[model samples]
Target: MKRHNAGELPLSAPAGDAKRGLGKEEAAEQGKVDRYGKGRVRWSRLCFLFAVVSTACVVARHCYDAGLGRGNSAAVVRIDAVPGPPRKIIPIARGEPSEEPRHRDPPSPPGDDATSSSSGSDEPDDIDDGAGAASSSKQLPSPSKAAAHGHQQAGHPFARALAAADNKADLCGGQYIYVQELPARFNKDIVQYCDKLSPWTDMCRYTANGGFGPLLRGGKAAFQGAGAGWYDTHEHALDVVFHERIKRYECLTEDASLAAAVFVPVYAGLDVARHLWGNNVSARDELALDLANVLAQRPEWRAMGGRDHFFVAGRTTWDFRRKPGAHAGWGSTLLNLPAVNNMTALVVEASPWHLNDIAIPYSTAFHPASDEDLFFWQDRVRALHRRYLFSFAGLPRPGDAKSIEGRLVDQCKASPACSVMECSTTGPDNKCESPAAVMKLFQSSTFCLLPRGSTDTLRAAFDALLAGCIPVFFHPASAYVQYTWHLPKNHVDYSVYIPEEDVRKNASVEETLRKISPEMVTTMRDNVVGLIPSVTYGDATSRIETTVKDAFDIAVAAVIDKVTKLRRGIVEGRAEEEKLEKYSWKYPLLAQGQKAEDHHEWDPLFN
Candidate 1:
C-alpha cells in the first residue's frame, strides 16, 4: 500500500482557505446569505450552491423590490467585494489591461492559458508570483469583470435568463423537459433569473465578484486545466452539465439532467473535464468524485457543498426500488451522453479481489443538516484547508529525467511492498519504451507507475488498473483530484504523497523503493483483479444503480430547493414506471468504491 502523506495537499490548500476561513462576521453573513447545509453546519459556507442561492435570493429581492427581474428585462448584478448596485456593461470586459497573478493566496480562478483567446481580463494565472508571502496577497481582474467575462455570449441560455430576469417570468424546468414523477418545469440557469440573481461569488474559483482587495493582486495566472472538482463517474459528469445548461458550462445542468448522461465517470471527469477548466471547458464536469462527495450537500454548485445541480422536473424510481437504490442523477443527461451505464462491473474490474489486503478510501458525504459540521468541517476545515493541503497536491513539476519506465521496474524490484518486473536487463523487444508500449508490456503487471505530464491524463493510469494492474502512483496531488476518480479503494488507492521537500530534495527514488513486500504486492494485485469487472461494463441495472440513480437525486433535489424557496411550487418527481430490479447495492460507490468487503476506508460506505 502506498500510504501518501502529501496526496491531499492541494485539496487542503491553494484556494481552500479563502472559502473556509471566513471570520465570525463572515461566517454569520455566510450563514444568512445562502445557508445551504442540512441545518447542521452553521459555519461551512455553501461555497458553491450557497453563492448561487444567495445570488438567487438577491436577484429575487431586487426584482420584487427594485424591479430588476421583471421578466424578459435583463439586469446584470456585477459581483464585487464591497457589495454595490450593478455596474455598467463595458461592451467588452477588456479586464484591467493584462496583468499576471499577484502575490496573495491562490484564491483566484485560473486564467485562460496562453493557448486560449481571452476577450479582456488582464490577470495572469500565476497567483503567487512564484514567491512566498506574495502568495498570501495577490489579486486578479475585478471579480465583476471576471464573472461577466466568464459568462459571455448572450445567445447562450444563461444569457437569455440574464436578459429576461428583469422582465419575463422566471423560467422553470417543466418548460425544458418532462419528468414522470414530478410535474412542472424549471431550470437552474442564472440567465432565467437575471436581474433577480446576484452572484455571491468568491475568490478561489475562476469566478469574478471583485472584492478580493489586497487578496487580489497582480497577474494573469496560467490555466493548467480544470480542477476536476467532485465527480466520480460519467454519471457525475452528466449532472454537472445538466445544471449549467445555459451558463456555457455543464455546471449549469441540474442533477436530473446528469442522470441522463452515461459514460465512464473516470475518463469523463479527468479527460473531458480538464479540457474545460480554464477557458470554455465545463469545469464542473471535471470535478473528481472525492471532491463531489465533499460538495454533495448541493451538487448543483460544485463549490457550495452540494451535489452536482441536476434541476429537471420529476424524480427517479426511488419510490419503486428499495435498499441499494439507484444512484441519483445530477443532471448528466443534458450533455451528449447516456444518463446511466453499468459501473458495478467496472468497479469490480477496478477493485482488488480481497478486503484485508489493502486500505480502501471512502467518502462519508457530509451528513447534511448538522451543527457540529458548522464548527468542525465548516469552520475548522476552512482553517485547515487554508493551512494544509491534505488532498492530492495540485500537479507535478517537470522532474529530473530518470525515465519513469525505468524507475517503475527499478522501484518495484527494490521495494518490498510492491511486485515489480526487473526489466533493466530486458532485450530491445522486452524493454517497452513509450507510455503505450510500456503500458501494453505491463498490462498485467501487478503495478505500473504514472509519472507526471503524460500530455493529458494519459492511457496507462486507467488501462493499467483496468487490466488488473495496480497503478503505482507518484503524483496524487497533481493527477488525482475531484475532477476524476473511478477506482475502488481497497481495489485501487492513492494518497497525499511525496512531500514537496522530498521531491525537491531529489532524494533518489532508490531510497524510497526500499519499502513494500512481495506479499503486499500480491495483495494489491489480488484486489485489483477483484475490482475491475465490478466497475466497467456492468449490467444496465448496475449503471442505473450507481450512475443514473445518484445523478437523479442530485438534480431533483436542486430543482426542489429552487422551486420550494424561489418559485414556491410543486416540484418534479421520478417516475414509478421506471423499473428498479436487482437493486443490490452490489457495488458501493462511496469509500472502498467498488471494493465490496473491506469497509475500513477513510471515507464512508466503510464505516
Candidate 2:
C-alpha cells in the first residue's frame, strides 16, 4: 500500500453543502441528541451557529455523507475526489471448515534476529490467568515460521490450519498482531481512578478481569463446561476482553514493523464514562483528546494514516461522538477526531451509517470456557423442556410511553405463560442482576422478548440465545442488522421479529408468539443454540476450541481481512470511498427476500 503522511489530510467538502437534502428522521436524530435521559442535549438553530465555527470539512462531510445527520451550518471547506475503480465486492471465507495443521520441522534460526524487537526486554514475570500462573519461555509456544513474515503471511493456509487446531493452537494464526504498548494513562491510570469515574455505579466491578468484569457467581453447576475459569463474566465489560485476548493472541508479536495490524489498547469506554453523567464535555473528552494527540505523534499513524491500526470500544459509537456545540452528550469526541476517523473502530454498537465503525457483540453472560462447555450448554438448551411460551425480563420504562421495553413488559406481565423478571433493584448485586436468574428465565421459556434497550440491542439477547431460547426483536437494528458478521444471514433461522408499531397498536405479543408452530419454535431454539458460540464473548483465558468461531475471533479476523483489503486497494490505486459494513457472514439478509422497510431505524446515540 502507498503510505501517506498522516499530517496531510485529504481535501474536504464545503460544510454548507452538507444539508442539501435534509430529511425529517435525520433532522430529529440531530435535533434531540438524547443520552438516555442522562446528559440530554438539544441541538437547535442557535447551536448550529456555534457548531459552524468549529466545523471542519472532515467532520461535516463525514456526517452528511455517512447519513448520520444533516449539516445546516455555513462551515467553510474544500472537497476533493480521489479517482478509483468501482469497488469489486469480495466474499470472505468465514466459518468455513479448514483442514488440520500440518506441522513443519522448525526452520534454522535466522543469521541475525532482525525482527526480534523484544529480545532485550525481560520476559513476562507472570502470565495472568486470573490465578497467578507461572509462565516461562519453554512453556509458551513459539511463533510458526509463517508468522515471522508479518503482513506477507496474512491469508496463508498454514496460519488458517493452526487456527483450526483443536487445542490452544486454535487461537494461533500466521497473521502477526501487534498490541501497542500505550502509556499507562490510556489504560491502567483510568482503571486506577475507576471509583471516581462514575457517580451512578461503582466502576470496580466493571473493570475486573481486564474489563470483562468478575465471573457470574453461579454458572459452573448450572452449565456444565470445562475451564469455565473466565467463561462467564459481567456482560457489560467488553473492553477487558479485547485488552487481555490480544496479549495471548497466537499471532501477537513485539515488533511493530512486523505486524499486519496495530492494536491500540486504550480503554476509551471507561475513560469517557467518568464524565457521561455530568455536563462537562471537556472533562469527558479529556482522555480521548489526549489519546489522539499521543497517537498522532507515533510513527505508525504517519506510516498508514492510521488505516492499519484499530481499537476496541466497549461502548456504542454514539458514546464517543459528542457533537461540537451540543450542550450535553453521553460520550467524548473520540470518533469525531480527525486522527481516529481513519482507524477501524470495533464497537459493541455501531452507527449503521458509519463506515469505519464495525459492530461487535455486546458482552453477555454464559461465556463458555471451552468447546466442551459450549457444546454441553448447547445440548442442555436444545433439550430444555420450556414451560412458558415466551418471557420478558426488564423493568417498565415509565418515561417513554412508546418505549418498546415498557410495552413488552406490560404484555409479558398480562400473559399467563410468559415469565417476567423485573429489573427493579439496587446495590452491588440482586436476583434481577444475577446471570443465574436471567438464564433460568430464558431456559424455562421457549421465546425470549428482546426489545430495544437504551440502544438498538442489549446484552440480554445473547444470554437468551445461550439458554436455548429464541429471541423476538421489535427492531431490526436490535440484532439482525447490527451483528451481520457474527449471526446467520437468514433472520428467520434463529429469531422472530414483530415491528414495534404493529405490536403497540394491534398485535399481541402472546398471540404472535403462539401463532408460530411448535416445530418452528423448536427449530428456532436449535438454531439459536448453534449460534451461541459465534455471538458469545468468552472469558479471555479459554482457548476457542470449538470449530465454531466466537465473537472475538470473528471480529479480529474481520479487522485483519478489512485492513489487508484496504491496503491492497491503496497499493493498486483502486481504493473505493466506501465500506463493507453491508457485507454479512453469509448472504446479505436484505437481498435474501426481507423487505427494506422492515429494517426499522433506531438511535445509535441512546446507548
Candidate 3:
C-alpha cells in the first residue's frame, strides 16, 4: 500500500452519482421537447402530474412497510441511502490538492503493510463507535453540520421535566457530551488488528470484553456477587476501555448543540503501538496526521478549534509527543500535532508542563460492576493484615543512572520487613504478570515502592492503590505532579514521598517507613482506601449502583470543567495569556521568577 501525506489523498466520489446523472439527462431531453408547442407543454404537464403521484405512492408504500407511516419518527436511516452533497475533505497543513497522484488503495487486510482496518464490529451499529466498513469503493456519510449544531425543541413543560429526569442530565451538572462519528480507520479498524498493535505481545486479548480483558472467576465471595465485574485488565487497554465507557456515558447527547463537551474516541495509543519499535517516522505518525486532517473538515472541530473536544491516549504522553527531527525517537508525534494540541488528552501519564495533557489512572485488575463490588473490595483491603513493612513489585533498571530501581531493590532485599518480588526480564511465569499475585503482594504490604521507570509513572502505583497499599514515590513526577486530577493535592494525604536524592545517598527504606507513627500510617491507609473508587475504572457494561464516581466518571467531569473554564477564558479574550494558569497544575509549583517553559532535569524522563 502506498502512503500519502495527510491532505494529499483524493476524496472518494459520492454514491449514486450515476442515477442522478441519468435524471438530469432525462430532464434536459424533456426541456427540449417542451419548447416545440403548447400541445407538447400540456402533455408534459400531464406526465409530470402522473410521475409525482407515482412517486408519492411508492414513498407511502415504503414507509408503511418500514413501520414509519405509523409515526415512527425514530426510524433508522441508512446514511448511504440518503442523497446528500459530496463530503468535503480538508488536507492537514495544506491548501487545495495539486493533483500529484494523491489517490491510494484501500488498506490491505491485517498482517499486511496496511495502515488501518476496513471492517467494523459484529454488534449493532452505533454512532459512538463509528462502526462501518470504509473503503475507496464506498463513501461513508459525513455527519451533517446542521444536525451537529441543531437543538431539540422543548415540548410541554411537564413532559420536558420528565424527559430530563429520564436522561439524568442533572446528575452530570447539566452537562452533555457529543461523541464524534469518525471513519473506521481512526478507531474500530485499529482494534480489528489488535494482534499487530504490539511488537512484543498479542494485544487481541486486551481488546476483548470492551477492553476489560478476560473475566476472572470467584467474584461472589470477594465482591458480594459483584465479582462478575472483576477482570484481568491489561494496563494498556485504557484506549479501548475509555472508548467503551464513553459509549455508555449517561450525559451523551446526539445533538451537538446541547453538548458541553465533545468526545473523539480514537484509539490513538493503539495506533502508535505497532510503530514504536520501527524506525519509520511516517509510519509512526501516519494515523495521527490522517486523524487531524479528518477532524479539520469537521464543523464541530471548527468551533473553538477543538477546545471542547477530548480523547483518551491510553499510553503515557511521552509516547505521543516525539521530539521533532529526532529520527530515532521513542514514539509518534500525535500530541504534538497542531490539531491535537488544542484538544484535551486523557493519558495514563501526562506531561507536567503541557496544558492539554491530563493524567488518568491506568486500568488495574479490579473493575467494579457496581458500587457493592467496589466498596466490598475497599473494605476487604482495609481489614487485611499487612505483614510486610514495604514491598517492591518491579524489575531493576541496570544502566540508567537516574533510575532508583537498583537502590530500592537492594534495600528491599537486605531488609526482612521488605517483601521484594523481583520481576525477571524474560519469563512467562513472572509473578508481576499475574494480576492475582501482584494484588496479593501489594495487599500484604503496608507500603508499595513506586520507583520511576522508563517513564515517570508506573501502572504498579495504581494497582497498589487498588490493593489499599500506600504508594511510596521517589519523584514528584511519578504520582504527585502527574495525577493531580485523581490523587489528592497534598501528597502527604495518602502517600510517602522519598526524594530520589535521599534514596541514592543510602537512606534505609525500612528505617524511613518505620519512623512514621502507627496512627499516621492508619490515617494514610484510610485515605488510600477511600481513593479506591476514584482511581478504579468501573465496568463499562454496567453502571455503579450508588453515587460513587469511578475513574471514568472523574475524568469526564474534569474534562467538562476544564473545557468550561477554557471556553469562558476564550470569551473573556484572555485565554492565550491565562492558558498556563488555567490548565497547568504545575504552574503553582514553579519557583519564583520561573516560567512554565523553563527546563527541568526530569523533563528527559517524559520526553
How many clashes show up per model? 233, 3, 0
Scanning candidate 3 in windows of ten residues, the lowest lDDT window is 126-135
**What TM-score does each of the candidates earn?**
0.26, 0.67, 0.69
The residue-by-residue lDDT of candidate 1 on 393-427, one tens digit each, is 11223264622444444444555544443333223
**lDDT of every model, 2 decimals:** 0.28, 0.65, 0.72
Most accurate candidate by TM-score: 3
Model 1, residue 244: displacement in angstroms?
21
Residue range 1-607, candidate 2, lDDT tens digits: 9889978979865755645556778756755654533443444655876778668766866776665564465544446863232111111122232222222221212221211311232331121111111121223234553233322323321222222221233233225576766899898887898787677777787677766666654555455443253334554467767788777665655434334578999888877777788878888878888887787666445435577789988888889887765667667888888778778888888776556677788777656667777777677778868889899888777787667777777778888898898887466455556776787788888888888866777888887887788898887778776777798877889889898888778579888877999788778877888888888766546564456678888888887777666544543346354434433211235564644334423332222
Q: Write the per-residue lDDT of candidate 3 for residues 355-443, one digit (tens) a residue.
A: 77888999987887777777788888899898899999887888888888988889889988999998886558788887777877888
Pairwise TM-score winner, candidates 1 and 2: 2
Candidates, ranked, TM-score: 3, 2, 1
Candidate 2 clashing pairs, residues 3+ apart or interchain: 12-78, 12-79, 210-240
* lDDT for residue 469 in candidate 3, whole number 0-100: 93
Worst window of 10 by summed lDDT in candidate 1: 222-231
